[model samples]
Target: MSTVQRALAVGLGAALLQVLMVIAFAWPAADIAPRDLPLAVAGPQAGAVAGTLAAADPNAFEIITVTDAAAARTAITNREVYGAIVTGDGPPRMLVASGASPAVAQQLTRIGQQLSGVPVARAEDVVPADTDDPRGIAFGVMVLPLVMAGIAAGVLLTVVIPTVGGAVLGLVTFGVVGGLLSMTIVQGWLSVLPGPYPVLAAVAGLVSFAVAGSVAGLAAVFGRVGLGVAALTMLLIGNPLSAATSAPELLPQPWGAIGQLLPPGAAASLLRSVAFFDGAAAAAPLTVLAGWAVAALALFGIAALRGARTEVAAPAEDPLPVG
Candidate 1:
């Protein structure tokens, strides 16, 4: 085969591999596990009652029974947990942190409705969401772009041994694109999503940065397989489980349960809080994103340095084995 033909074939193969990797990673994260959400419950037999309730709905909460309403309220303010539930003869009241988890917010609503016989009312001590922000919609906005950037970074870095540098380049590209589309084109053609252009731009940049760093870092570790990690992180696992189109409460138990751990899900919750809600909006999400970025950078840095040292040390031994 001609050199040009071989090059073309190799490029196509790499592209195909990347695409498949993305599909594999980005699919099947429809299930959301509740994991460790802090919750406050109050009732006469709060301990046994909360434990039983938690056992019944493990996917819904990490239950903690508070001493009283005042303690519940205090717990929420201090950011000790995401939501609270109080049981009484007449009805039940749930305290939800609107900014923390849209899924949790939705879950409170559904739980309120399901407690038949008893009346349930949601209390508003926590900060409320914006009239404009749709809790779940935030995921699609920031996550989609981030996932794309990650996929691109993974592919570009796979063929090159110093995948870290290539991955950084990919992140830079995403940031640029996000700035242009979300910021510069505020009034352009992106009216499809609604919201101020500035807000969108800021979100876009953050998402881009996170996705790029994550994808690049993963690729540095796994080589071609890193594409799958990136895809799973942003597209499949993160996006579907994210509180994008629907709140966790809105989804079935599994999706709601696992949603918080995903990046898009976390960011989606944060964006909704920043745009419309007020409670603990920035703290958790900022920490999550910063954590992701830091971890990615660390991994990429270590792997990259090791790879460079290896190449320099080994330096290729004789390649003259032709017929």
Candidate 2:
């Protein structure tokens, strides 16, 4: 085969792979419907309501029977459930947390309205998205640029610095800059994410660190290919799997579980916890980020040590002869 033909084949193959990945990550989400989506039910008629909803569409909701409307409301605010149905003598009331996932909230509301054998009185948003970005798209999508910046920083720092200390310095510097910049755009300028500014900035910083560390570690081990791998893992798989546009349970099967385990997914979940749930569910995701950062740091050390040993073993070039 000619060199030119081989190159063309490789390029086309790469392009096709990218296209397929995009379709795999995005196309299915276009016409999203509930799939074991968490929902709470309250009052005496809760069992009947759950039974009716289940009978209609068995896969639509994962119902949790709560004692009362107060408990149901608590579940929504804590982000324990996406929405709730409250059954009483009068019309049934639907409560939801739009802040957790606006799409899920809307879906639950629709389901509540269409529920058979009982009239749905009203659908209320217990927790809504920030005023500036009511739809919450910005909150989810903005993480893309932040992750990209982290990846770039990781690769560049590893290439230029080479030493573990220098790499640490680079990571810290980039993380602070990225975090502050992100906080400014989301909170200061747009007011899409509400203060406390310091808390938001800290969350951003952690995300930056986790992403940067992972990329740098990969690059240290695999060179250029590492960067591409990191990009694919974080952006292509992590972003859509994170369920930023919806809830994790709404995602298809194991992809949802896998997404939550990745850095991008963990970061997104942590931010949501801080922003809407008052940091109630922050512990688990925070631990996930910390674990990634620590593991990457270890990788960085190994690479640095290996490079140093190679330098020590290599024969020195003969000094130029002086006249």
Candidate 3:
């Protein structure tokens, strides 16, 4: 192809990709809806309250009836439920764990107001976000940089050390350094991660490893095209679909469901569980991240072996005898 034609093609492709990203991300925010969101209802009238909520939105909530407000609070803190409605003789009370997701908390409070026969009063946040980050969105912000770092680490590693073993070493070092540094910034300085330091660091390391290893594997398999694909997948598709600023349930339809299974969403879920839920609901997300890491590593290994074999089969380059 001519240079001008090639440039035009590249430009058009980049423009199209950007447009797609915009649509993919904005579509969810345009029409937010709840889907199988966990919730607790307390008191003797809990069953009735749950029924009413069900009638309003049959598929919205997975309601669990608790004995009292205390139990409801416990459930929220443990991440067993996102929010709870505590019914009693006076006005109803709603308990929200803002640390998990401020957007979800706000939405649940609104739901409580609409559902309650009397006025609804919200209790103090069971697990509030960091004081500096009242909206709890800093967590989402932190994720972007870490992901970018992972991408950079993976790409640079391939450029600097093309061997699979070298790339693996680079990924390990990147994971450890990036994880600790990020944890120090978000947890130590910002007080965003209130969980145990060891747990937070461990999860961070896993997230880093998953992202880097996946990118490295893609590059190993498809060369430069693989790098572009990996970038698009992580930045355009994975991150936006993650719904890190809110609960996955608060996002639109299948996208929300799809996001939770990806690395970004899983990492966010795991972090929330660790920080606000005492690591109570972390197992599923942890498994998801582990799967990503293992799969990526396997792909990288296979590609490396194939590359080595190809090199062995190829004829050696002829050398000039004189200068």
Candidate 4:
């Protein structure tokens, strides 16, 4: 291609990349709404509340009926649902877990007001967020740094280390140290995350390892091209689809579910679970992170074997002539 054409092509590519990044980050926020969002209706009026919610927005919530308000609280604590409505002899009460998802809680609070025909309805936050970061802003802000750390670790290891084993060791060490450092800042200093220090640190470390390992493994197998691919995927797709700023159910359908499968999304969910819900509903995210880490290790193994074979097949050079 001519010089001018190449320049134009590069400019166009950059523009396209910017456009895609915008869409990935903004689309979910623009399209935020409940789709099959889990909710509970407890007490004798459970059926009536469910019917009313169905009439309002048939697809808004996946209703789970329970015997009483206590059961509803249990469900919320267990991360089975975002919120609940309880009805008895008196006025209805709304139960929310703002720590689990402040966005969901706000929406449910609105719904509760509408249901009671009052400007402010009776609402209780079963699992309130920490006082230091009531809006969950700190938690949301944590995702990007973790991702960047992973990308940096991966890129540096691939460029600096000559062997895959060395890269793996370095990545592991980074994960552990990074986790401790991150927890110290976010939990100890800022007091954002309220989970047990040990567990939170462990989850953070695993998240770091998952991202860094994947990137390094990809680079090991496919060289620089693989590094680019991993970085872009984690930054553009994984970060946005992570729904760290909001609940997954609040985002567009399927994409929200799809996000949970990626490292960023899984890490966000896992962190939230451990921090607020006492590790409730943490199995899926844990599994996803583990799967990525395992797959990355497998990739590293494959690259090592390939490198070994290449070395074995290489022809030996002739000995230098003696004087």
Candidate 5:
């Protein structure tokens, strides 16, 4: 290719990358709305409440019927639903779990007002967020740093460490230390996460390992190209679609679901579960992180074995005859 052609190609590629980044980051925020967001209606008026919600926005919520307010609260605490409406002899009450997603809580609060046809309505926060970071801004912001740190760890391991075994060791060491440091800052200093320190540390470690290990393993096998691919996947695809800033149900359907399958999304979900929900509904995210971590380690081992076989197969040079 000519020099001018190459230059134009590079410029066009840069422009395309910028456009894709904008779409990845902004699209979800722009189109934020409930899509099959789980909501509960308790008491004898459950059907009526469901009908009202459906009439308002049929595709917004998936109404779950329960016996009473207590059941509704239980469901919210267990992370089964985002919020609930309870009706009895008196006026209806709105139950919200702001810790799950403050944005969703705000939406439900508006719905509550609409249902009552008043500026204010009877409402309760069954699972309120921490006072220190009520809006969940800090929680959302935490994931990006962790991801970047993981990427850096992977890059350093691949470049600085000469052997696969050393890289694996470095990855593990980074995970443990990184987890401890992260938990200390976010939990101890920031007080954004209220979970038990040990568990939170462990979760943080797993997240680091999952991300770093994936990057390192890929790079070990495929070199610099693999490094770029892994980093971009975690940053562009994983970070934005993670829904850490909002609930997964709030984002576009399949993308939100796909995000949870990636490291960033799984980490956010797992952290939230341990931090506020007492580890409720944690099985899926935990599995996702574990799977990534295990697979990454396996890749590293494969690379090491390949290196060993190549070394053994290589023929040695012949000794020079004495002069």
Candidate 6:
């Protein structure tokens, strides 16, 4: 084969490989929905009522009995329960935590209207998210930053150094920078986000590492162009498809399903729990993120180490009869 033909074939093969890698990560042709969500019930009398309500709508709201209304509200504040139903002698009130999910509040209102034939008053304890921070929506900002950082790491590897060297640098970067970011978050350096300090720190660290590792892995599998594919994976396909700004419940058919497997989707869900809710429901999301990161890192490490091109030494002709 001609030199140009060989080069073209290798390049095309690398490009296709990168695309497949992305598809494997971002595509989830499976189901994605919450089976149970934590819900605190305030009044003892509310047990039957809330239980009945939940039974009627088995898909959402897992009712957990709290001693009193105050306690229930506190649970919501601490991000334990998504919200509560506080029943008093006067009238049963729905305590909605807008921060956890404003869409839930809307759903509750609709349900209330259906049940009572009148609009039941709602007490919003946890308010809706800030309008200013685009990133804060569904913890997308937090996840996006890390994914972008990872793609950047991949680029640095392919462009500035050998694939193996670049991957090593990416791993180190994830470890060092991620740890430092975690410390800052734990120390309460940023006030815009109101979740637990430790949770933020841990999440930031893990996410950073995941992004970096994924990028490195892609670089190892492909080449310089692999960086582009990684960007498409984490940014264009992952971010846009992820229900970060829009709740999965509200999204359209394909995008909603597609979003579930993306790093942003997985990480954002976990982060929301850490930041806005008690860690009770974060296990699944955390596990998903961990799995992806670990898988990417393992594959990258193996390929970068093993699939290396051997250094070719030029043959020297014997000095013709030692002139």
lDDT values, one for every candidate = 0.62, 0.82, 0.84, 0.92, 0.92, 0.63
Estimate the TM-score for candidate 1.
Answer: 0.58
Misplaced by over 4 Å in model 4 are 319-323
> Could you give the candidate ranking by TM-score, starting with the highest?
4, 5, 3, 2, 6, 1
Please state the error at residue 250 of candidate 1 in Å.
9.8
lDDT of 6 by residue, 1-323 (tens): 99999999999998997787566434532433333556777775777767677677776566788888789777876666666766666555667665566655566556545544457555554545534442344344455666677667656665666566566666767656675675465334544556566667677767666666676677677655665666677876676555554355445455655666767676666766766666646887788778867877776767755654332344556887855
What shift in Å separates residue 301 of candidate 1 from its native position after superposition?
A: 4.3
**Model 2 TM-score?**
0.90
Q: Compared with the true structure, what per-residue lDDT tens digits does model 2 show for residues 12-110? A: 999998897877677648647778888999999999989988999899888999999999988877777888989897767888887888888777777
User: What tens-digit string does per-residue lDDT give for candidate 4 at 1-323?
Assistant: 99999999999999999999999999998999999999999988889999999999999999999999889999999999999999997767899999988888899999998887887675899999888988888889899999989999999999999898999899889989999999999999999889899899999999999999999999999999999999999999899999888899999989999999999999999998999999999999999999999998999999999999999999999999999
Model 5 scores a TM of 0.96
lDDT digits (tens) for residues 214-321 of candidate 3: 888888888999888887788777788888888888887788878878788888999888877788889989999999899889978898889889999999989988
- Could you tell me which residue pairs clash in candidate 4? none
Ranking by lDDT: 4, 5, 3, 2, 6, 1
**TM-score comparison, 2 vs 6, better candidate:** 2
TM-scores vs. true structure, each candidate: 0.58, 0.90, 0.91, 0.97, 0.96, 0.63
Which parts of model 2 are misplaced by more than 4 Å? 1-3, 116-121, 311-323
Worst ten in a row by lDDT for model 4: 114-123
Task: After the best TM-score superposition of candidate 2, give how far the Cα of residue 290 lies from its true spot, in angstroms.
Answer: 1.5
